[model samples]
Structures are given as structure tokens and as C-alpha cells.
Target: MPSLVRAASIVAGAALLLLAPVARAAPAAGGYAALGDSYSSGVGAGGYLADSGDCKRSANAYPSLWHLAHAATEFAFAACSGATTAQVRDRQLSVLNAGTTLVTISVGGNDIGFSDAIETCVLGTDEDCTDAVAKATTYTRDRLPADLDATYAQIHHRAPNARLVVLGYPRLFELGGCFPGLSEAKRRVLDRAADFLADTTAGRAGANRAEFADVRGHFAGHGVCASDEWIHGVTLPLDESYHPTRTGHAKGYLPALTGVAP
Candidate 1:
């Protein structure tokens, strides 16, 4: 695990600075704000904070952990479960202002029906899983780019001085394991879907002059079905299913952010 984090940090030195056509410096870390969906809100990490209500922001979530690690002038945790890019633009951006120095966001999955696609892979046949993943891949290629561009533009507009970091999800499953869960084919497709999501996100982040913290390498060997899993299976509070565990936030996400954070 330590090796994984170190490798990721080394890789992020160049990778995280880049937007594809341009590179930007990491933000001044003050008056921080976190925004986006369940990944950013910390649904799977557990230890829910009460004040966030149905949003279920977790004490162990990456944002809280990040705030605890820094001495920012102010902090706002506005991410929520099931939030789409539009939802984030409409509801979460209120936390941003000219004084906001750094922002982290993880959204766009819900808008492409990530949960439903996974449901098909989990409960349906291989053909169903392939179809679901295919549709999602197409949606990401054809539709999500425009939506992400708009959302990123809005975030920059709202917080002109903030350094924005767009965080990408990790692959959820290991290639082969002893577990009797989804078939190898399904796992392959699902992992491909994650790749598509991450690639699209990185592209958009670079286009907007924001940094992207890719966690895939950091979480590589600890996905579901691995000997030491960092992602949840079909767990209770089903919303947490297929999301990162607390270890993922601390070891995977924290290090990934530390690689790019100023």
C-alpha cells in the first residue's frame, strides 16, 4: 500500500499538473470547499456527520480528512449523494466565493446512470451488463463532455481565484479473485466503464485549466475482490455499494490529493 501511494505521488507530479493542452499550478490551499456527488461527499467511507443530514457526509470522507490535515481560513463541505453536475452547479456552488482558494469535486457519474448500469451488471445477464456499460461509454463520449464543460465553467466563474481539482473514481474490481461475485466478463466491462469515466474527466479538467487527481493507480491492488479490498461489495446501506471504504479515502484519496495539493 505504501508503495502504491508513493508510486502514485511520483506519477502525479507530472500527471496532476496537466490539463491535456495546458498545465496549471496547484491552488493556494485556503478557504477550501468540496463539492460533487457521493464520492466527494464520502458515502462509502462511513462515520456520517449529522449536520449534513440526508447528504451523509462522512467524518472519514476525503474532504473532512483534508480539512483536518490543513489549516484553511474556512471550510465548506457541500457535496451530496446522487448529485449530478447540474445539481452541483445549482446547489453546491454557493460555498464558493472570491476568497475560496481551493476546491475539489467528483461528479458526472450519476448523470450517466452509474448506479443503474451497475445494477444491470450485478443482477442481470452478461449481455445486459455489456449493453449497460456500452450505453454508459457512449453517453460519456457523446454527452458528458458538454455537461462537464458547462459545470466546470460555472465553478470557475463562481470562484475565480480558487484552484480547482477534479477527482476521478477508481476501478471497483480486481481482475481475478476467489470471490464468487460478478463474472470475469462483467468485471472487465465495469472496469472499462470506470476507465472511460476517468479519461473523460481528465480531458475536461485539463480543458478548464484545472488539475485532475487520478486515484486509479493509488487504489490499484486494493479494489473489490482483492486480498485487501478498499471498495465495498453488496454492503448494508446499499448506497455505499461499489464505493471506496475509509481506507480508500485515507490511503488512496489522501495520497492522491497530497500528490497534487499545494
Candidate 2:
């Protein structure tokens, strides 16, 4: 009887030791809040998230996939279908709280309506796209840094302790003649625009002490016009043209999310 009692005591102590960490590892106070637009929501990608009404957010989006892979305790996805920087501050920032452990965002594409410009000008004369690309590039270069700063400040204010990761947009066009549908001139214009967005976002994130995910490098030759494309081409198989395919989402976004757990 004495031996049995001693053994039982030892078993109980071991159980407590094992369970302590599990109990303590519950989701942080406010959980993880993901903010951004269609790209972050995985619009064209099919598996990141359950398709929701407001954002059309997919279950396979990187953020959602990150949460699942890590078994994140709490998740608040506020990314909308067509959110801009202003929308992030106005609508989503408030949801963040001090206990939040992780926050990821991808914005700025909709600010100047780059997708519209691509669809309109890239499909038209090469000269037209070149002109539009130049104008759009100028606008993004001038205004994007300030907008990024404000967005970062707002997110920090709301979730002071959370590790913020700002994802740069992926390359939308190939460097050379990869996209047969789009003229070589138009492809150059699109590639330049994509490069501008990536550089701006990375620069801003560095200044703000947030992690910058340079997703463009991951899909070097897989832009809109590439034969083995990650992003959808100008003439999408379906109606949606700007979003990425599931493979693109996995490649373009998942690498940036590695080890991003709360």
C-alpha cells in the first residue's frame, strides 16, 4: 500500500508538469488579427480559408494556413475584398489589442488600382501601358511610404506587443517575353510596377521594425505572363484575374509565414 501511494504521487506530479505548458500556451489575449485586402484573403487561391461573404477570403490563404499549421488559439481575419490602407486603419486596426501576438498585412495594390491599369493598358497598345505604368509608378513611389508609416503606426498602437509582418506584393509580370498574351513592352511595364510596390513595402516595413516578406523573389519567373505562372494571367481562366492560384498562394505567401506562430 505504501509503495502504491508513492507511485501514484509520482504519476500525478509528472502529469502536472506535462500539462502546465499546454495550459499556459493558450491564445494570447486578443489573438492574431490579419488585415489587408483580396490578396491576403486568398481570393483566387482556393484553400487558405473558408470562402467568406465579405472578403471572399479563402481557407488556404497564408495567414489562415499559418494559423492552422501552428494550431493558433485565436484568429481574427478582417481582410476585406478590396481594402486599401485607409480601410485598414478605419475598419480593422481597432480589433487589435495588447494581447495580440501576431499580425500580418498586405495592402497598397488597390490604392492606385494597379490591377485595373494592367487590364486596361496592358491589353491595349504597348505605348499606352508604358505611359500608365510610369504614372502609376510615380504615384506609388511618392505616396506609398507615408501611407505605410501611418498603417504601421495604427497597427502598433492597437497591438503593441504583436509581431507585425507586412507582406510585399508578388511580381505580377515576367521580366522578359514570358507572357505571350501581353506584349513584351506591356510586360516590362507591369514588371516595373511590381518591383516598385515590393521595394516600397519592404522599405516601409524595415523603417517600422516590422518583418517585411519579400514575396516577389519567390516567384521570379511565375508572374502573369510566365508559362508556369503563379499569379493569374491577364486573361484568367475564370473571371477573377488579379489573384493567385493555390500553388501561387502556397509559394508566394507561405514562405513568408514560416514559424510565425503565437
Candidate 3:
């Protein structure tokens, strides 16, 4: 009887040993991958990671913040500043795999000529700004849907198991305290553009079974014009302008993503 009991105990031990590698290989939870543009890459947040270079990935980005908060996950920060939908599909999708349990993206602003629109609104005449914004609005209404859908499909293909979260652009201005040269009327137009972008993005996210992380109200009262602004206001070295500040990442983007990141 004693010999039989010893043999059964050994069998159980062997079974546990065999399962150990499988358990490690398939983490019961936690594997995160971040992909997208300046917002996700921390372009305006500063403190850029040396290895990321022109991508301008920053340690203060929401993805990094998420990873820091949830250390158990296998985190991949593949987002880059100024990335468009095509760039995300071609360059960033490689980071995801079957094991990726969570994914987040903030893109499309670049795809619709976001920088040009901003330039027009801030530096050009009212008519020029209006025309540029009108064009952008048309592009969002027409061109962005297909592009966003394709990108969402690609993401789903790469990380079939991951829960995708798509973040939208925030309205950069408030009704008051306009930037030095940028007018309130132009800012309102810009705000409308932002709304269009967010709406388009949210629609795609829904179709793709992904969560849309709406940043509209999250950034309320913290726009570039705010007394304690979270977003940068027409800074030098072009790259720094109109991007989120570090505090923006911490308080705004981080909270928005965290609320639905997983």
C-alpha cells in the first residue's frame, strides 16, 4: 500500500511539472501592446526615450503609464509620433501577436492632414483656415472611414485575442484665452473638426469590436487656453506645439485609457 501511494504522488508531481511551462507560456492574464500616433507616442509629453528617436516616444505616454501601473503584463510600446493609419498598419502591427491581451491606439489625426489644418487655423487668414478645415471635414466624412476600418481589421488580424482601445483627438482650444495669434473663431472651427474626427473614430471602433476612449470631456477646461493648460500652445521647434504636456499624459490620457485600457 505504501509503495502504491508513493507512485501516485510521483505521477501528480510529474503532471504539475509538465503543466508549468504551458502556464508560463500562456499567461492567465496580462500582455499589453500600444500602437498609434503622437498622442499615444507622447510627442508633446516630452522626456522622449532615446531609442525611439524621431518617433518621439516618451516615458510619460499613456501606454508607458499603463505598463508602469500594471507591471505584470508583457508590454510593447510601438506607437510613434506623427503616425498615420497606413504607418500603423505597416510599421506598428508587427508588435502584436496572439498572446497580446490588451492593445491601445490613437491615430487618424495625421491621416487627415491634422498639422496642416492646425497651421492654417493658427497662421493663415480666416478664409484660408476655413477652406483647410472644410477640406479636412470632408476627408473625415469620406476618406477616414475606409482607412480606419482597414487599420482596425489589420489590428484584429494581428492580435485576435487582444482587447483593442481606440483613443480620439481632444479639442485643443477653449472658448476663452486663445493662443497669441490664433483667433477664437478659428479655434471653434478646429473644435468642430475635432468632434468630427472623434465621431468617425468612435464609429470604426464600434464596428471593430474595440472600445473608443473618448477624450472630449476628459480634456475639458485643460485645453491650450486654460490657466493650467494640459496641452502645449504653439511652442517652438514645431514638434512641441499643440501636443499634450506631461501632466496631460498623466492626468488626461492616462485616466482615459486606464478606464477602458484592458
Best by TM-score: 1
Local accuracy of candidate 3 as per-residue lDDT tens digits, 61-135: 888899998987787888876677888887887777888888899888877876677765555677888899899
Candidate 2 residues lying further than 4 Å off, grouped into runs, are: 1-29, 47-51, 175-180, 235-239, 259-262
All candidates: TM-score: 0.87, 0.82, 0.87
Candidate ranking (lDDT, best to worst) = 1, 3, 2
Model 1 collision count: 1
For the record, the alpha-carbon RMSD of candidate 1 to the native fold, in angstroms, is 10.5
- Error at 211, model 2, angstroms: 1.2
| Model 2 agreement with the true structure over 1-262: per-residue lDDT tens digits | 2256544443343222101110011123587777888787776776433435646667878777777876745887777666778777887776688988889999888776575566445344788778777776877888878888999998998899989998888767676555235667777777778888888888899999899887877878777767788876532223246567778878768886673332
Candidate 3 lDDT trough over 10 residues, lowest sum: 17-26
Best by lDDT: 1
Backbone clashes under 3 angstroms, per model: 1, 11, 0
Between prediction 1 and prediction 2, the one with superior lDDT is 1
Each prediction's Cα RMSD?
10.5, 18.4, 19.4
**lDDT of every predicted structure (CA atoms):** 0.80, 0.70, 0.77
